[model samples]
Target chain A: MKLFKKMRGGLSCDDVMEVLQSYLDGETDTETARKVASHLDECTDCDLESSVYQNIRVSLSTNKAPIDPVVLDSLRQFGERVSRGEID
Target chain B: MTERPTEVDSPAASADATEAFNRYVIPELEVMYRTARSLTRNQTDAEDLVQDTLLRAFRAIERFDGRYPRAWLLTIMRNANINRARKKRPDLLDDPDLTFERSVDFAETTGPEELVVDPTFDASVTDAFAELSTDFRQVVELVDLNGLAYQEAADILGVPVGTVMSRLHRARKRIRDHLAEHGLDSAAALPRGATR
Candidate 1:
């Protein structure tokens, strides 16, 4: 299956893997992201990896504590004081 | 480089700096705190870091361009953390704690044979994250969680862009391997639109 998939595209799984991080991070040029996305469509392993990567990113960003209100207020006040030349 | 304002001490100049801080920098304190927490992993230390970061930033507000405040602040915070770390344990600079990665027996947990038998394992993503090496976790938190651009993350972490990409790739791979171990590798788990 992997062999057949590779035959259809210029990017084999290895090729896609090499630039997959840049593609995922949206740092890749349009041409490269397109190629990797095209390859991932037919490559189950790469597809799985792509999704797992997205899920992990979502999981990391979704679950987090809100910044403490006290902390925010204090930082704001401190900034004000610095502006006023009250604190160095 | 953006040219720094000539005088930050004049009342008008100070007021402008204050206004910029309120409009541009204050809004990003939450993210700054989040990154600080990730770096310190201790509540008190995170708070101190945030305070120190704000202090340093306000002092240098005349030089700030008000573009990409989070990245700018993170760069400062990263430096402050390094300085703090150096002060506490100067020798740690010579010897990093790389043992955390080696201490984990990946073979037993993520071995291919074990993955096959696990059937349907379930583990929290957070738990898997905790098991990652500090270096990997730092990249994950900065780039993945905080949504910093790769260059921004690299700038904040003081590594090359290529290093950021490679570390992010390996970090995500580790998390995926952990998920696979727990039997979360179902096709349904893949996000919609993963394919063209």
Candidate 2:
């Protein structure tokens, strides 16, 4: 339960929307995130919108093109060589 | 600003630097490669970029304090990417103070049925990510995808934390709207409010 709501009134939908990313990203202060969470509990629109944003983020993160094995090996070898000053 | 060449003052110090590079920097190649791939969006270019970054990091290895090597490597990669981009097209450079006022605007062009029933959400998301401007994509990759904090991403990109916040917000909105346009059928497979 957000007991802080009694100390600070709940944020309006527009206000919650304004910082929704920060709220989701855990960038918001504790009081502000709790306020946003409280708003989402009562507002289906913001809840669904937040869900969609998260999905997009997951997609971007997981959809990376696989690195070429040869390129990977080459980079590793290069790092080793460079680390040892085997090559300038 | 003029650049000073990094010099290894002694053989013992050089060996220490090499040891540090193996211990601190080698372990972070995968992350560096991923970030490079995201920035360059090309396999060849990404490889070259990582190579260039590693070279620079190696030269400066003696000065590294073994702190947050991944972030330090990423900052180098970001600078290398920008310098490469600047050389190709000077206008692609970012102006940190420019207000991204339209960060919240979106075109909700997709229907709920498409999001809930379709299976091509990943493809659509990939396309949308490609469609993003380089600036927006940088924050998304560093903050959202790479799981770096706002302050860390800002430091890596040489931008203010506020800029990272605003740009990331805008970039995520565009992505959300793009997913919405495709009807987010993928969400049906996920529990409500599930995040990576």
Candidate 3:
């Protein structure tokens, strides 16, 4: 089934996997992204691969260390000082 | 010796520089701090690096054409970080605790109770992330954790954009493989059409 789908002029599973990360990252060009999307829609294996990668991204993204608001506030104040020419 | 007159020396020019700094630099402080944290891997050093970058950006604000300010500031931050690294003791440069390994430790200590995904899956991903080389971990931290674009991560790492993409893809592939090994790559783990 996958082979038959590959012969249908869309990106093969190999081609999709080659650029899969870029396609997921939204870094692929529009045409390539469209092709990859089309391939994923038709290929169960590639779609599962994409899902696993996406899940990994979500898991890792959720693991971000909490940013300290105090530090951000301090930086903001420092930037304000710079804008006011208070810091040399 | 008399200092030559410059654009920044005039009152009007100083005001323009200040406005430009406020417009371009001020809004990006959090992002600057996050990138600094990724580079320095220490809170105190990250804050100091950002402060240094802010100062340099202020000094150069008059010359900035108000385009791609984040990229502009990241370049300054990268330079500042390089200078800071140069001044550090050689032994201190090899401090493993100051690496992204610490970020993994932080993840272990913090709970992801709010995430709806499987805890085991999350743990597997974190384990895979912790095992990545420093180069891979740095790119992941900058692009994934800090939400930086490929070019932005490359600028901060002083590498080519292609290098960033290559490292990021390879690193994530490692994590995906780890997940597959743990049997977490099953279709049941992820719904159909699930994507970020």
Candidate 4:
């Protein structure tokens, strides 16, 4: 399905799909990221796929559980004691 | 067997070690705690794990070379967690993969009736997240929720970086599918003025 359709940088929609997640996560290498970006720019189908994934990321991120402040404070004090050589 | 020479740190050396611990390890406590929480899935265990990690890091501070402290601390935390698990469940010694299966029980209280209404994109995503398997949800929690990079998540989860990528992408794909089912796949669902 659209495997042979080449977009910018000669990346097919399938090729972009393979690494699109990595590209969105900023985990892809420079060259592959560039190619995937170009392909997304030219291919509406791939672009929509990217948008959907991005929107999902945004939604998931919004629901991040808040770290407990009391827990964080205790950890900080623990670190301080460790730094002061109070704890072995 | 030859006995090794006893070593003792001079005052200056001890001070330097303390300085290094403060400089490198102090700032990463929160991240360490958060990762520990993800790994232990319980508040008390997470606190214990982080304290254990801190003690180990303090002991090793003199030789740390002060580079990539977060990565270094995470590696220590991973080892510490393995030891904790081994001590708790001796059976885990036979299968190493079982050591990293800690699950994060996020949003377990949201009832099914709440999910039935309000098919907004956010609601769909929350539903999908709840439905994800422990492995998929763990990866998402490490990378997306906890904001750890792929390599960092892999280090904490005791998996390869590629494994993290695979789990994270599949998890998000599942969420995207859920959104599509709610008619959120169209361009209208994209953020306003989102060119990418």
Provide interface RMSD per model, one decimal.
Answer: 9.1, 7.6, 6.0, 7.7
Predictions: Cα RMSD each: 7.7, 7.8, 5.1, 5.6
| CA displacement after TM-score superposition, residue A33 of candidate 3 (Å) | 0.9
TM-score list, all predictions: 0.75, 0.70, 0.86, 0.86
DockQ for the candidate 4 complex? 0.45
By lDDT, the candidates rank as: 3, 4, 2, 1
Report the lDDT tens digits of candidate 3 across residue range A1-88.
3545463127878888899988888899999988888888778788778888888777778888778799899989978777777675
- The positional error of residue B82 in candidate 1, measured at the CA in angstroms, is 2.2
Tell the DockQ for candidate 3.
0.48
Q: Which runs in model 4 stand beyond 4 Å of their true positions?
A: B1-13, B100-104, B109-119, B192-196
Q: In candidate 1, what are the lDDT values of residues A1-88, reduced to their tens digit?
A: 3555353246977787787767877888988888887787787787777776665565555544446688777867765665555565
Error of 4 at B28 (Å): 1.4
Alpha-carbon error at B17 in model 3, in Å? Answer: 1.7
lDDT of 3 by residue, B73-137 (tens): 99999888877775774454655234323343435534666345677888888889888888898
Per-residue lDDT tens digits of candidate 1, residues B1-196?
Answer: 1223336643443778878777777788777877776667666787888878877887888899878887788888878877777777777685433211223322222323322222233234666766787788778877776677888778767788889888888887887778777677564355333333
lDDT of 4 by residue, B1-196 (tens): 1122224432223678778888999889878887887788888998999999998998899889878899999999999999999999999998756876755557653344443322376676887888898889889988887789999999887889989998998888888777777777774355532345
Clashes of 1: 1
Off by over 4 Å in 1: A1-10, A41-45, B1-13, B92-122, B191-196
lDDT of 4: 0.78
TM-score of chain A of each: 0.70, 0.69, 0.89, 0.88
Number of the candidate with higher lDDT, 1 or 3: 3
